[model samples]
Target: MAHTLAQKILQAHTDEAIMAAGQIVRCRVSLALANDITAPLAIKSFRAMGAKKVFDRDKVALVMDHFTPQKDIDSAQQVKLTREFAREMGVTHYYEGGDCGVEHALLPELGLVGPGDVVVGADSHTCTYGGLGAFATGLGSTDVAGAMALGETWFKVPPTIRATFTGTLPRWVGAKDLILRLIGEIGVDGALYRALEFDGAAIEALSVEGRMTIANMAIEAGGKVGLFAADEKTLAYTAARGRKDAPLSADPGATYERELTFDVSGMDPVVACPHLPENVKPVGEVRGVTLDQVVIGSCTNGRISDMREAAEVLKGRKVAKGVRCIVLPATPGVWKEALKEGLIETFMESGCIVGPATCGPCLGGHMGILADGERAIATTNRNFRGRMGSLESEVYLASPAVAAASAVAGVIAHPGSL
Candidate 1:
């Protein structure tokens, strides 16, 4: 039987000569990642397992990015616990303060993630690394602890759902829009426990950063993993940093549980409004809906390409009165690159506050909390209840272009409206 890219990677990692959907396999992990919110729990569980040391210290990366700068004493203590464990384990990839961004966004930049690798993280968005052709997914703290100790974790091979994007992607329409459209069409649980593999000419034309945005949101649709076939863009991104990932592809006759195709020509910018990431609507449909704040950053849309897109829309323009716009680069590296390109200056001159590389407002940890009855447009992953602060506050998920345009208009405005 032919195999999908995910199956191929899994079969290679597992002791088994073959792996199929629904089969359980314990595959060796190439990388293990955790953030401040999950690392402490993983460490505690690691200790409970009577493990004297991690299976591979150099492969584990513990980052303090979710509540960066330490939201408070409790958050600081949580980070401290992870730090001590990392120090004791001699973990080589530990990231502190300014050294880290969101683990999903930073690992690729460091050349620590690559194709055909089995990567797992304690955070759901870890699948973002799948943009590089790796078979990556998120596991619970206990799963992480188990993987940390044994260098492997059990997985029930998920059936693949092939989503093919054809035609040219319209200007201002990005991966965020494409993924949001998918969620809207299939609902949030559409791909529950399924591996979503994206392909076709449109997806092929996407930059690695754009592909990362789509892959990062696969979990938002209940996907086990989101992947793109590693192409030249992916190879160039990793190879320049002294890493090389052999490209992998699904066999021509690979079977899929379900198949979907989207024709993206002239696709409009879309948004996922309050209460659910699947409640997507076209950006023009939400025009004039008042907003108190706009956030243009997160693991989902905080890369340099996203920054350039936002800056392009906001350049020579000022934010609307009574509207607050906050922008965060995904990593310190992204921050530096944006500064070098003057994207940071454009944002700041437009009345947007450019912040450090942090998850910040995306998880309501800190930096830009919303008030009661306030509404914000953000380029983050989730927008469920009380996700950004008070339960009364609302968040609308959008692309960085929509985020910037909305900030300038003080509403959920479209770039065309501006």
Candidate 2:
């Protein structure tokens, strides 16, 4: 039996030898995570469990990112409670300030996740760790509290579905476009409770950052996890991040329950418009759609590479007179690197507002809110109605390049056209 990355991680953690789909199985967890918004609730639930302390404080991580810098009283209180709990539990890995960005972005950068590990977080984007060949998934706050007490969690083995892509993507086509297209084809709930394994030459050609972008959005399609096998590319990425000795890859002969094939050689850049992530249309079809705001950052596409790509498009071009553009780096590390590379200067020269390294407008928290009837084109993962602002506003989701190009044109435009 040839198992995929998801299968290997599940089997390694399983207490039972013969696990079947839909049958609950107890499994060991390599790491557990909670951020400010969810950590307070998880802590409350843990106390209700009457546990002496966390099963292993070292295995738990607390990150204050969702409301970094604390905007309102409720958010401030959440951060305070999360910090108090972390201090009392003696959690070794606690991230705050600019050190905390999106939980998924900070986890891999801090070496908290690695191949062959099973991680759980209270944020849906936790599945981004699957890019490192880890079987990571998101859970409810109560479920995280249970994992904190027992160091284990129950899971029904997910049916594996492999998405194999062949052929080179076009200049403007990116991982975001590919995943959005998949969501369009499968609908929002098509992959419910299933493991999505990406394979083939096309996937192998993508960088780790690109792969993370794909895995990060799997939740929007209702997938448990979007997994990619660890090849040399995976090894090199972790190695560069100071985890040179980390375990890597799944065993050969891994089994998959189903497979899908995509021919993206001629694929066009896509836009997930108005409300739903799955409501995708090719950029060619919607190139002239006007936008009031354009954002180029999020857990989905907020890495240094993503910033650089957008910066390149913004250079020598000012944001459209009436359009406001916001650029947020995913983490302080990414921000510092972009600064060192002069990418920050390019963005500022183009009249783009560089926000703090946080989730920012991706979740409609701190930046670029739209007024009634206003429209935005953003690089964030979801464009669900009212996600970025008022219910009357509209959002179109695209790659960072697309967002940047659109910002300069005052309308949706492909990066190549810039």
Candidate 3:
């Protein structure tokens, strides 16, 4: 029987000989992850089960990113608890302050996740791994604890939706715009419990980093996962990272519940307005709207490619007066690469504050929280109410190009405006 990439990957790890959508099946997990905010709870759950140790320490990753450097005494205690658990379990991918970064970005860079793998993390952005053709999804802390102890978990196979892209994306119009437009067309609950499979020439042309940006936000549209099938690009990335994993692809006649097509050549830069990632509109539709802050970071768009794009727009300009601009590198390694490439200097010289690899500001962790009535245009995934700070604050989601341009104008702007 022909199967979609998601089904194929799931079957490879599943014990049953035949599996179909909606069928509950137990499958082996290739990787399981947890972060500072969720790891403590998962660890507590793990201990309560009286599990001797993790199923496979090397296959689990623990990252201290959500509140890195410790937000307060409670956060510090949580971090300490996570550290002890990781140490006790001999976790091979434990990341702490200074080296910690958003787990979604760090895992891919380390080659800890790859095609055909079943990965689960205690993070909505764990879907980011699906960009590499992995069957990845996010789970709760208790589920994570169960996976840690058993190395396998049950899943209700989600039906698939294939979105094919055609033509080249216009200059300044990036993956973020494409995704935001998709969310707008489909709404926040569009793909509830469904797998979104990306394909076609335009998707193939996108850099893995760009695909990561799109896959990272799948949760915004209520997708079970969003992925690009294994192709030459997937192999090249894995090889470059000095890791090897079998690439998987959907059969030619694989099934999908519905299909959508996008023509990037005619697309424009888009932004998701305050309160919902699906409240999207073209930049021109909301141009000149004032902003209180601008941030370019998160697991979504804080990689080297994102930094380079933002730096280009800010090369000879400064962040608008009174509008703070914060630049976060997605990982320590990404930070070092950006620094060596002079992107860090370019940002700082342009008056944008360069921050560590932590996921600060994106989730109201710290460093750039907003005050009441404040509005920020950012490259992070979500833009829900109070996502960055006070309940009255707002966030607008855009591409690095739009973010950089808006930062220079102190309002929502576009790359063409710059």
Q: Score every model by TM-score.
A: 0.99, 0.97, 0.99
Residue-level lDDT tens digits of model 3 in 1-418? 7898888889999878645789888999999999999998899899899998999989999999988878889999999999988888899889997767878888898889999999999888899998999989999998999999999999888899888888998889888888898899889999899999998888888999988888888888999899888888888998889887666789889889999998899788999998999999999999999998999999999998999999999998999999999999889888999999998999999999998888899999898999999999999988888999999999999999999999999999988887
Clashes of each: 0, 7, 0
Superposed by TM-score, candidate 2 places the C-alpha of residue 66 at a distance from the truth, in angstroms, of 1.1
Pitting candidate 1 against candidate 2, the one with the higher lDDT is: 1
lDDT by residue (tens digit), candidate 2, 157-242: 88877788888988878888889988898888978999898877888889888999999989998999989887788888888788
- State, as a TM-score between 0 and 1, how close model 3 is to the true structure: 0.99
CA displacement after TM-score superposition, residue 358 of candidate 1 (Å): 0.8
Candidate 1 is scored at a TM of: 0.99
Summing lDDT over every window of 10 consecutive residues in candidate 2, give the lowest-scoring window.
244-253
Per-residue lDDT, model 2, residue 287, is: 93
